[model samples]
Target: MQRKFLDYFLFDKKDNGMLETLYREDETSFPPFDTQEVSFYLTPEKRLSLKYPAGEKQELSYQGFRDNITFILESPFAEYFEILGSPYLDLEVRTGAEDLDLFIYRRAIDENGKTVVLKGNHGEPMDSFTRGCFRLSHRDEVAKDFDKVRVICQPPTPKSGVVPGQIYRVIASAHTGLNMFARLGHV
Candidate 1:
C-alpha cells in the first residue's frame, strides 16, 4: 500500500516499539492499545481504516501534508510497536520523521499465508519501466505456514510479462517481523 512510514519502521525483536495499525496519516494522534487503538488498513479510496482507542473501528482520510511536507498525522509515544519488514530487503531504520509512537498494526494473515508489504521500489523512479514489485511464494500450499512463506523479488528483466514496478503494497495479513532467514529466490 501507499505508506508514509509503516514500511520503513525498523523491526527489532528486542526493540521494535510499534503500536496499532492505523490508516490515515493523521492516525498517529489517535488512541493506543493499553490506552488502545489497534491495527489499520487502506480502503480502495485510500482512506485509512483503523481501530480507535475505545476499541472501535474507524475509517479515515489522508490528512495530507503541511507546507513543510511533514505529515499532519502524529501520535503520542507508544509503549510498543511491531514494525514489519519484508523478506526481500529488510533494511534497518535508525531514524524516522513520522511521529507515530502509538497505535501499532497487529500482524495480518490471509487465506494465502502470513504476509506483509510495508513499502518498496525495485528501481529508480525515472527508469521505472524496468522496476519490479515484491512477489510471494509458499513452501507448502495447504498449511500456509509462516515459517514456510516468503516474499521474493520479481526480477528486473525486460522480458518478464508483468508490468514493471506497477505493484505496490499488496501484502496482506502480515505476520509481525521479517523472517530474515528465509531462503529467497530470484531478485
Candidate 2:
C-alpha cells in the first residue's frame, strides 16, 4: 500500500507562525497537533542525506568570489521543531577546501512584502568541518522572528580571491522522534 503523508510548511512566519497546511486529499480527521521535539542529521558522503522524512540533500560548486553560495531548507516539518530545545541540526562537511566558512540565516518577510534573508546572530562562521552538531537558533534582540533557515558556504572574503574550481560536499538532516505529540488534521 502506498504510504500516506502530510505536507506542512513548518516555519513560514509570514503566512503562519508555526504550521501552514499544504494539502489533504482525504477527509479523515486528525487530532490536534502540538509542539514536538525533532532532530536533524546532515551528512556528506557518496550523496547528501537528510534524516527527516521530507528533508533534502544537495551538491554544488562555488562560483568563485563574485557569487554567493547558498542552500535553502524549506522542509515540510520545520515548524514543529525547536532549535533551542531537544531538536537540532547536524552538519557534516565531508570534503571541501580549507578556510571555507558556513553562515546560517533565517528567511523572513518584511513590511514591504519583500522576502529578506536575515543573517544568523549565532556568532562567528563555522570554520571547521570536524563533524559537529549545531543549533541554528538566533538570540539577538533586534533580530526578526522566523521559522525556516538557509545556509551559506563560501570563502572568507573577496580580498582572498575564490578558488577557481572548489567543490564542497555536505549533508544536513533532521530527526524528530515519535515520542513527541502533535495536533493531527487535514488541510
Candidate 3:
C-alpha cells in the first residue's frame, strides 16, 4: 500500500525528497483523499453528469465541482482546520496557464499571530477542471489528526447569481485529516 500510494506523484525527484523528509520526521503518514468526481460540460447551461472511472483515474464535472467546493467548506474535516493555520498552498490562479508557482511551508507562530510562508517549489497548474491532490501527515498513530491541501476558487463577485468565466484560485493547507470516507464513505 505504501509503494502503491507513493507511485502517484512521488516518482519525481523533488517529490521523492519531500516524501522522504515527511516520513522521516513524521510518525503518522496518510494515504491520499479523493472526492467523488463527475463530468462538466462547457456549455452555457453548465451541464453536469456522473462518470464512474472504469480503471483508475476519475473525471470531474462542473456541478460536481460546485458540490465539491461546498462539501469542502462545510465539512468538518481536520485537514480543513489544519490548512487554515498553515502556510500550505496559496495560488493566484489563471485558468489554462502553466506558470502557477504553488508551494508550501511551515508557518511561524509568535505572540503576535501566525505567519504563512511559501516553501521549495511552486507547482505548475495542471489543465483546467482537474482536482489537485494534497498529501498531509496525520497526527496520531491511529492517524486521527490529518493534514490537508485544498484548491480555492475565487470568482468575481456575482451581480445576481454566481459569476461565470471568472477565475479560480488554489490554496493548500494542512490541519487535520478527515475520516469522512471511512466506513464505506458514510461520513
Candidate 4:
C-alpha cells in the first residue's frame, strides 16, 4: 500500500564526482549523470559516525571524496510494484579500516523497460552503533520488473592497490543526527 509516486533526484554524485545534480529544469539534468562514476563525499561536514576500531592502520587520502546517491522512483500504474519496509542509509563502515567495507548496488526497470542489477557486499561484522543501520533492499531477484535504489558508499576495490578506499559519510542535516550518531544507516 505504498503508492504515492513521483519522487525525483535521478542522478547525484556530489563533489567527489563534482556536482552531478541539482534538478535542472527542462535541461534534463544536463550532462551530469555523475560524470561516469567517481564519488565519496556528500557535504554537511562529510558524514560517517559509528566508531570504535582504531586498532592500528593509518594512511588516509581519498582525494575529494563523493560517495553516491541515486534514488529515483517513477512507477505507479500497477501491474507490478512492491517495496515494503523503509529505504534507509545513514551508514557506517570500518571493516578494520584499510579499504573498509560497504558497497550497495541495485538498478531496476520493468514495465516493459527491462533492466536489473544487484550487488551487495558489506564487510562482515558490519560494524558498530549497535551494528548501525544499512538495510536497503528490493530483492525479488532485483525487484523483478523495476525498483532501483542507488546508494554508493565506497570500499572494496583492491587488486591493483591492496588498500585505500572507504569513506562513507552522511551527516550534515537532521541536526547532524544529534551531533552525529551518523544515524542507523543503510543504502
- The superposed Cα distance between candidate 3 and the true structure at residue 2, in angstroms, equals 22
Tens-place lDDT digits, model 4, residues 53-145: 344533333422355543333222233222222233433332334443334333344345444222212112222211122312211222222
Give candidates' CA RMSD values in order.
Answer: 19.3, 17.3, 19.0, 20.2
Clashes of each: 27, 17, 17, 17
Give a tens-digit lDDT track for model 3, residues 23-131.
2223243332433322222222222212321354333333322333211111122232212112233222332332222222222222233222223323332222112
- Give TM-scores for every candidate, taking all chains together and pairing residue i with residue i: 0.21, 0.27, 0.18, 0.18
**lDDT tens string, model 1, 66-105?**
3211111122222323233332222111112222111113
Candidate 3 deviant stretches above 4 angstroms: 1-92, 95-97, 112-166, 169-171, 175-187
Report the Cα lDDT for residue 72, model 4. 31
Stretches of model 1 off by over 4 angstroms after superposition: 1-39, 51-78, 87-148, 154-158, 162-187
Best by TM-score: 2
Top-scoring candidate (lDDT): 2
Give the Cα error of residue 107 in candidate 3, in Å: 1.8
Candidate 3 is scored at a TM of 0.18
Q: Per-residue lDDT of 1-187 in model 2, one digit per residue for the tens?
A: 1111112223322322223333222324322244333443333332222454444665444443456433333233323322322222334332234344444433333334344432212222322212222222211111122133322222233232234235322322222222221321100
